[model samples]
Target: MAREIDQAHLLEYTGEFSFDHKLILEFIKTAKPDYDHTDPKTWPLITSAYLNKWLIKPYSGVLMLPPFIAYERSLVDLCVADREDGNVELVREDGVKTVRSRFHHHFPFIYNHNGHKRKFEYMHADHYTSWVFGVTGKVPATRTKGKDTPSASADPFDEILELIQDAQHAHKTDGATSLRAELESAHKDLDESKKRVVAAEAQQKLLDKELTHERRRAEGLVQSKKALKQDLQKAFRGEMEQHTITQKQLERVNRELADTNKLWREATNETIAAEARSKKLEKTLKDRDKDLQVSREQAATLQEQMVKIRNELKKGMEDGGQKRQADSNASSSQKKKVKIQQ
Candidate 1:
């Protein structure tokens, strides 16, 4: 039977399921399922079934049943047949029993159920369909379900199947309407992105032009700086030449001043010698004047002596002549007396 095959697959899958004793215990506590509460070995089977039936089954689409639900139905059928032997020992090729431990490689994005790697393929299929509708601006065809309404006395399994079909039909109809609106909005966003890119390119061109203008200005400034530096060098050379000329002129003036000072000293010495000679000549002239005055006094005394001698000689001659005349008269008188006596 088909049920028997499904059960066999379930058993094999459970045996390979990595045992996580702690995770299973926590799942059992939260879910509070109708299973053995004390035994930790039975936790994986109970928790896996719970997750498949409640979390994964209801939202599954009509076209593709989720892997979790398919696995769970097999487990359920096995339990109904013989619930006692559900827990089986899982072993590796090395003959070492797989202990209760968490699956290390399990993650949110990767769905590794019963040795099959599905990824996030069917999980968000409706969301992907809606996105396609929004982009294309098209509505997908609706999937119709059975119109027969079940009576109150209908089998419980039949009623449950009918409700699941109705729910899938409603989900498809709502998704198509919402997707159309999303597609129109996505088209407008694409137009806005294109406009932004064009504006950015225009702005980039303006920036490049400004950069070129600045480079030209920088070159002009460099030329001006070089010219100014050359002018400064020329001015500095002129100032140095002027300083050399001024130093030479000052040396010439100093030599002239020394020559003038020497001439003035020589002239002063000559004037002093001439004044000494003039004083000596004036003393000689005063001595000569005193000698001439003594000569004139001696000549005047000699003239007075000569005049006195001449007056004495003239007086002596007059006395002598008078005496001679008197003598002659006496002799004549004596001779006359003798003649009278004889």
Candidate 2:
């Protein structure tokens, strides 16, 4: 995922300041030699008055003063100068002397010390100067006059020339700083854009590889579809040939069935003719048997008549014989009588 840009301004101090009240009291005492340090309330009042006089009053035009004072390890937090103006001189020894006088005269309880003591000198001047330069972007001015009092009437042309030089330098430095910041920002954007472009290119490569695989799969499917179509056409042709052969066989079977029916009809007609002839033959045989019985009865009656005729002839013959015998006897008797007479 892409990251969101951080649009917030960079913070100058990333951590909190470690405030040292003891250090602040010491700083106040340095400004006023006899400033009371015993009273618990006195510490806050004196520190408030000192900060108001030196730090707050000078920069009041540009920024608001914080309610509390804090310092870093190196006391850098004590420096709060504006970059646009060179007014840090107001927070130096000159400002401290003014605050001390207020405490000595008006608030004596806070500053109960002798008046004849030597004037107090503010310490950490170099640190304060360096801090001012860092904040204002202005170079520190080198002191050329040491213990020499300047004349009352100074050269106004020289002062005007120095002011012009300072203004020109400040302008050039500001322009350079702005240009540097813009260049750094551009470099950061370029690096982020390069990273995004690389990521997009990798993603495009993966998509291309996936597309190639899909194309191959589609081609394979097309080839398989074509093969299946050819097999289906071959199967359809074979089925058509088989159907034609089956139709021819069915026609031959129909012809055979018709021939068998014709033969069956002829056989049935012959059987009917044979049955009529056998019935006629049986009737003729019955008439011939009746005629044969009549012929046998006539033969028996002729045999009985032949037997009666033979018996009558035999009786006649016997009667004739008897008559002859009687005659012969009479003749023999006549003959015997004639012989005896002789």
Candidate 3:
């Protein structure tokens, strides 16, 4: 019966849910025990750090975005079930779903639709961290004037049973008078809750301003960083140009040096060949002189033998004289040939 009643209420609420703001405030407190949740200014800083840590991006924008995809918002239908069984999920994830396909980006939708049929006019700030942590984005309002208040419509004993009965006739029984008193008290409490909501909304506006200022300061810092980078690149560009010119000059000088080395090697080889030829010619002249010395010795021996023969044949004077003359001519020719050989 309770489940049926909850399902009926769910039918009436075709859109999202809204939970107590204190739950989120409590979450902030648990997340950062150092910061004071009472201080409105700290919310933005905490939220930014939370966003940066979980989503890999700050609260302002994404880290890297693609150029082809337009920076525009598109509507999507998020469907999920409110579980009651033992199965639960607790993984910390932060990202938008639409861009997860091709870009690998996970930024979320900024504008939260409030009413059942969300139109453009109903754009309001979502009182959420955008981090999915097993809780629905919507739940019933439970805080009033910094105090938790019970709804007048719900019965103290049995919420589902009371909801099943009509609101006008639910209290018309033995506990009717007490129920009326409780109802009146609940109404008074509701007024205080409304006042608290108003105050919280005002405080949220101040927080938004602080967030805006912080974002502007961050943007200024980014701009200054970009300017510094440009200046550094400009400075390095001159050195790079000089380096390129010096490298080219060195290459040209190396080529010239290589050519000089090649010429020197060729000249040295030619000199070696000329020296080898000169050595061979000197060896040939030495061998020729040795041969000429042997021939001179032989010619001297032959002249001595002819003189002996002429003495022996003293009566044959004419023949001996003619032979002597021929021998003298041969000796003179031999001397001339030896001189030419030297």
Candidate 4:
């Protein structure tokens, strides 16, 4: 349930109605120089005079003095409770405000004090976390004897009853002369009582409507908070799922990069080995060409020596045939001359 405002408690709790805490404490000490404010038992009794003296007339014509609050912290005039001007306003989460007026419980009540009927608000003091509502005034009331005002021992209710009996006796003794005036007074009092009752009933109906509206506002606030909590929970879950997927993709990419680096290292080693074998083959081909040129020069020298030996043999045979023919002709001539002479 949304709480209805307790005007007295709100007055004590809010600084708007009370004087400065330090100033109130100073006033308490000034009221009783020797009284121990720390000890509740020694604290001076509060009275209307002290409360009255504490309030200076406010610059605003509406200055309400403290005596307006009765000893019970209630409005001194209960019949005027319905006529108060207090209001309440509530602010919603969307920045809209609902205003209500004519709250009556506790008041800047009007009461008679200091020989003048003055407007008064509540007055309270604080001492080390404990509040001293000028509920106990700065001064105590002293009764002096021989006055029309009630004595210190008088019971006000008993006095009012006694005065009523005295009035009845006087009217009876005065006879027909006072009867008409007495009847008129009774009729006036009855009319005022009826007016007060009608006002009280109208105020009660207004209070009932305000209470229903406050209850609905409280229920709406609870539902809005529950819906906001659910939205935050869903958003957090989606972010966590997306974070998990990204982490898995990063791990897969790292593994693929490692495999590519391993293949690059293996290919580089094979290329180095192939280059070393090609250099060795080129050195062997150069050595083989030098050996083939030396073998061709030795074969050409042996062929030339064979051709010179054939030419020398043919010339020696021709010269020997010619010398043999000459020797045979000389022998034939000598034999023919000998035959002729015979």
Candidate 5:
């Protein structure tokens, strides 16, 4: 099976960068930072600040930031679940309200965090995992109210939640970086592969055309063989007819010699003249046999040429078959790789 890289997974970092593992780790030490009383609240506050920078900006434009914020909100909701002990309390400037009712169940999946309306469901699961695991901390039940004592107290879920947040941010940032690099590499490979595919297609087309030509050539050979067979049959018939005519001529000559011998025997009694006539007939028969031998050699050469053509056609057919099979296998492998990616 062919391996295809997933570009999306390669760059995990995106959005507001809330889930950066490094940021989560650094955040754990501070937990919730103290508000500066000396600075005026209205002086100026950076609304777009993200511990994980990638988590903050959704895209290059204004359209990008909202989705990431939504994801971060979702993680917070998942993390802070309702405990049955009623120990949890929500404090405001007005006063402290203890969580008492079992009916509250859990915090809503959609809630406002840091004045931004964010939803946990919108956040990616990986982001949540990073936030939960990367940052190490404990969530204390109450905040100490004294200058000498630290205001923030460690709780069991604090560090874990922070880690989860950090991991997600780090994952996205690294993911974006890795994705950029990978996309570049994939693009290059894709271009090269496309070139190879084009060449393969061209070669396949040429093979197809050659195979068609070979088929036509094979058909022509078959026709030629049939014509040659007919020609040989005609030659054989002509040879037989000529042999019959020669035999008739030889018989006539013998009959004449017999008549002449009869006359000679009666006139002067001559046997030498009959012996010379018989030797001449034997020489004519030998000359006819030599002509037949030459004809047979010509036929044998024609048969050899026909056999060579047939062999060439057979070899061409086999090569074309193998090439088509290889193409089919390659196509199948490519399909399987695509399926795996899906």
Candidate 6:
């Protein structure tokens, strides 16, 4: 019977689920210690109730968003769920249906499987954090604020049940109560919730757009780096080719230098031999000139001796002729004296 009632309530709750800010705050404030942590079926009921009150019918303006404990600060968003143009659109996640609303990014949406038709808007701060975790998975740390609250010390669940009961009784049994006043309060709360949802949705859209632009810039930088590397490689290859050609030319010049050195050595030897022959010719000419000078002095001395002997011979002939003439004169005188005596 309890199971049947539970199922029946689940069906009804799913069909009428909507955001209700007051209900959410009340539930968190009044959660019992005995709220079954291990039961899967109970979780759906709890989640459906929570999402319905906060996301669909309650204040949809500002959502309280905190990071998932396991994921830590990594995945967190504050959302405003229901405003048009400023809302984050609902993108069907690959494996899951009814994820956060892509509309009004500031007010993130909550999905309850059992109450799939109703959408819930999260409060902009910690509220969105709780809502996201509740839908994706349960967060053990989160619970109602009531028993934890210092004010009314009582059984948490009973306290919440009594509060609901008293409110109902006040509306039904109390007479002469102004229905207009209560309706006005409800409308005011709903408007505030919607405004918060709009704000959160706007923030989420901005983040997505920024992330897309950053990715494109990174891709461009990578392409630029690749082009620079290719140019450097081409320049290095050209320099290597030039260096090789220069080295080959240097080797040829060295070979020509070696051949010129050998030719210089041969020419030096020939010059030394020519100088030796010239010195021998000079000595032979000096010896011939001294011999000719001695022969000329001897011929001049022999000619002077021959001229003195010819002069002495001529003087002897003149003396002999004078003696012969004296003898003739004497003979003539003697013959004349003999004739006169006779």
Which 10 consecutive positions of candidate 4 have the poorest summed lDDT? 124-133
TM-score of each: 0.24, 0.23, 0.21, 0.25, 0.21, 0.22
After superposing candidate 6 on the true structure, give the runs of residues whose Cα lies further than 4 Å from its correct spot. 1-267, 323-342
lDDT of 4 by residue, 317-340 (tens): 344456667889999999999999
Poorest 10 consecutive residues by lDDT, candidate 3 = 1-10
Q: Report RMSD (Å) for each prediction in the order shown.
A: 78.9, 81.6, 55.7, 66.3, 49.1, 68.2
Give the worst 10-residue stretch by lDDT in candidate 5: 37-46
Clashes of each: 3, 0, 8, 8, 50, 67
lDDT of 6 by residue, 1-342 (tens): 011112223211222222243443334334432322222223223232344354433322222332111101111222222222323323222332222433322212232222232232222223333344434443324332211211223223223233334444544222213322433343444343344344334444444443343344345434554555556557556656777647676676456545444444433433343343334434433443444344344444433433433333333334445666788888899999999999
User: Residue 235 in candidate 5 has what lDDT?
Assistant: 62
Give me candidate 4's TM-score against the actual structure. Answer: 0.25
Off by over 4 Å in 5: 1-174, 245-342
Candidate 2 CA-lDDT value: 0.35
lDDT score for candidate 5 against the true structure: 0.35
lDDT of 6 at 234: 72
lDDT of 5 by residue, 284-339 (tens): 44554554455455545544544443444445445656777899999999999999
The order by descending TM-score is 4, 1, 2, 6, 5, 3
Model 5 error, position 59 (Å)? 70
How far out, in Å, is residue 133 in model 6? 99
Q: What tens-digit string does per-residue lDDT give for candidate 1 at 198-315?
A: 4333333433433343344345444554565556557656656777647676676556556545544533443443344335445544543444344344444433443433343334
Model 5 TM-score relative to the real fold: 0.21
